[model samples]
Target: MKALLKRGFNLLDSLFSRAFTPAWNPLYQLGALSFFYFWIVAVTGVYLFIFFETSISGAYSSIEQITHGQWYIGGVMRSFHRYASAAMGICVTLHVLREFAMDRYSGPRWFSWVSGIPLLWLLFASAIGGYWLVWDQQAQYIAILTAEWFDALPIMVDPMASLFLNESTLSDRFFSLLVFLHIGIPLALLLGMFIHIKRVTAPRSNPARGLAAGTLLAMLAVSLWRPALSQAPANLDMAVTEVGLDWVFLNPYPLINSWGPGNTWVLLVGLSTVLCLLPWMPSRRPKRTPVAVVDPDNCNGCGWCLADCPYEAVSMKEHDFKKGHKQSVVDPDLCVSCGICAGACPSSSPFRHVDELTTGISIPELHIKELLARTEASLAKLSTDQPRIMLYGCDHGSVVPDIQSSTVAAISMPCAALVPPAFVDYVLRQDLAEGVLISGCCEGDCFHRLGNTWVDQRFSMERMPVLRTRVPRERVRLRWLGAQGTRALQREVVEFQRELAEAPALIDLEDVSSG
Candidate 1:
């Protein structure tokens, strides 16, 4: 099931990449886009609230005035509020599905995945409350159905449905309660949103400027074309047999009608429980996955590991061995075992003369020494003298083994970021391979969030342990082709090999001295 979903997402990603480009792709920025839509909803909702009436009798009339009398500004704001809320729901749903499809909602990521579940419930509650405030026939239907749903709960002492039994029963106080809830629930949702990204190192709370502007313009165009207008005023005497429904929030009403309120609640609760437990379900991660371990001897309390850790697993603490200085401490429970810290550590440099190649921080199972040995062994197997290429790929991205050949050697790491910049320089300076091609998860789609981004920054000399300026830039290539990029990886490696063959040979200082 997961494999199928992953393939579907890849197809959509490819199609959307052509239209919006990878940087502005809506699918890649779903979480950020959801946040952007939320802001739009909040701003437009505030405008609508300023002119709103908190009385059952006046609510319908005020909405009518806003819809027709002030059609230019107030009307547009109402439509923006409605559509942006729907857009937020869509983006949030897609973000959850995409994360699940990519198998990112497990292990150390479980906290983020679990925290997001409550936000869904809060969002629906807020939207439903907003609809009730309109005081139209649809809102009347929603109010009665929701009251009945609440009445089904065992904790309800007095039935909520009794309040909406007759025209005389409703009061301004009841309407005011709806208004308060509409405002209060969304504020709670906002807090949940913050908690959802608490563990992420650098959360993307906003989408790209171009994407944001485009989304807002599209919403504006929609508001201008089809303005949101309320139905006839709610009538207690008349039965609300038929009314329009916003499927994003009111889709559950149909289930309530088909299945009793008890059954509906059972279904919703069951679904939420399943979603919360998904991270603990049988997953691809090994039972005893190795976490990063800090080497106090090599660690100079640099704090690079702490900065590079995506899960906030690495922290700076007073060194037990070296007084005054600090050392990185890994919280075993929080570590995702990505090994990005290994790449960021300056001590990971291959140039360091040591019997055992160790870094400030590294995964116990796949340490720096193991990676260097793998790279050397892979490169040695390449018999061809025609511009040999060493391809480094991550476990989650392109299948590096598929493209391995006589001329090309491939080594897979937990993440592409696990390959230090010094390793790239080492490969070239030692003549292990003529060219090095680093490929991993697609741009903005790294399994370990910032793996590819950090790799790019390190290669560009914008981050620590920079790739040497002396190494020819042409010999090093970075390709982010995602999981199904085996063929693309082959093409890139071939092109890189051709480029290396056409370029001038690297000078050998040892040969010059001998000559």
Candidate 2:
């Protein structure tokens, strides 16, 4: 099932990439787009509230006035509020599904996945409350159905639906209560949104400026084309047999009608429970996942690991052996076992003279020494007569083995970021490979969240452990082709080989060492 969904997402991503570019692709920016739509909903909701009436008798008339009298501004605001809310729901749902399809909602990511479930309910509640405030026939139908739905719960002794039994039973107080809830629930949803991204190192809560502007313009065009208008005023004496519905929020009403309120409640609760437990449903972890380990002897309290970790798993504390100094600590529970911290550690340099070649921070299973040995072995197998290229890829991105050839060698890491910059320099200086190609997850859609970003920054000399300025920039290439980008990776490798063929010979390392 997951494989099928991932393929579908890859196909969509490829199509969207051509239209919006990878950086501005809506699929990649789903989470941020949700935030964008939410702000639109909030700003327009505030404007609508300023002119809203809280009484049942006045609510419908005020809405009618806003729809017709202030058609240019208030009417547009109302439509923006309605449509933006719907867009938010759609974005949130896609964000969840995309995360699941990519298998990112497990292990250390479980907290984000679990925290997001409550947000769906809160969003629906807020939208439903807003509909009721319109006090139209559609709202009337929603109110009565919602009341009956609640009455099915075991905790409700008094039938809440009885409040709408007759024209005299309903009160303005009930209308005011709905107004309060509509405001309060969204505020709560905002808080949940914060908690959802708290563990992420640097969460992107806003989409690109171009994407944001485009979305807003599209929403405006929609509002202008089909302005949101209310139906006739609610009448308890008349039966609500038919009325227009916003399926985004009122989708469950059909289920409630077809499967009884009790059955619908059961279905909703069961679905929520399943989503919350998905992270642990089958356990995606390996038999033994290796976490980053600190070598206090080599550690100088640099704090690079703490900064590079996508999860807040690394911290600093007073060193036990070196008094007054600090050492890095890894929280076992929070660590996702990504080797990005290993790459960030300056001590991970391949030039280290020590026999064991230990680093300040390194993954236990794939230490710096083991990585260098693997790189050397892989390069040794390549033909030196040709333009040898060392291709480094991550487990979650391009399939490295598929692109290996007599002249091109491949090394797969837990993440491309795990390849220390020094390794790239070492490979060139030793003439092991004429060029080094680093490929990983698609731009803006890293499976480990920040792996590819950190790799790019390090290579560009914008971050710590910078790639040496002496090294030829043309010899090092970084391509962010996604997991399904095997063919793309092959094409990039061939292109890099051609570029290296035309470039001048590598610098003389022997002369530099003697100088």
Q: Could you tell me the TM-score of candidate 2? A: 0.97
> What TM-score, computed on C-alpha atoms, does each candidate reach?
0.97, 0.97
Per-residue CA lDDT of model 1 for 1-515, tens digit only, reads 87898899999987887798878889989999989988988998889888899998889999889988999999999999999999999999989989998988888899999999999999999999999999999999999999999999999999998888878889999888998999899999999999999989999898989999999899889999999999988998788988999999899998887899999999999999999998887765546578999888989998877877888999999997898989899999988888999999999988998977888899986899999999999898888668999999999999999999999999888899999999999999998899999999988888999999899989999988689888789889999998878788899988888888888776753356458
Model 1 poorest 10 in a row by lDDT: 505-514
Candidate 2 at 193: error in angstroms? Answer: 1.0
The global Cα lDDT (0 to 1) of model 2 is 0.90
Q: Could you report the Cα RMSD, in angstroms, for every candidate shown? A: 2.1, 1.8
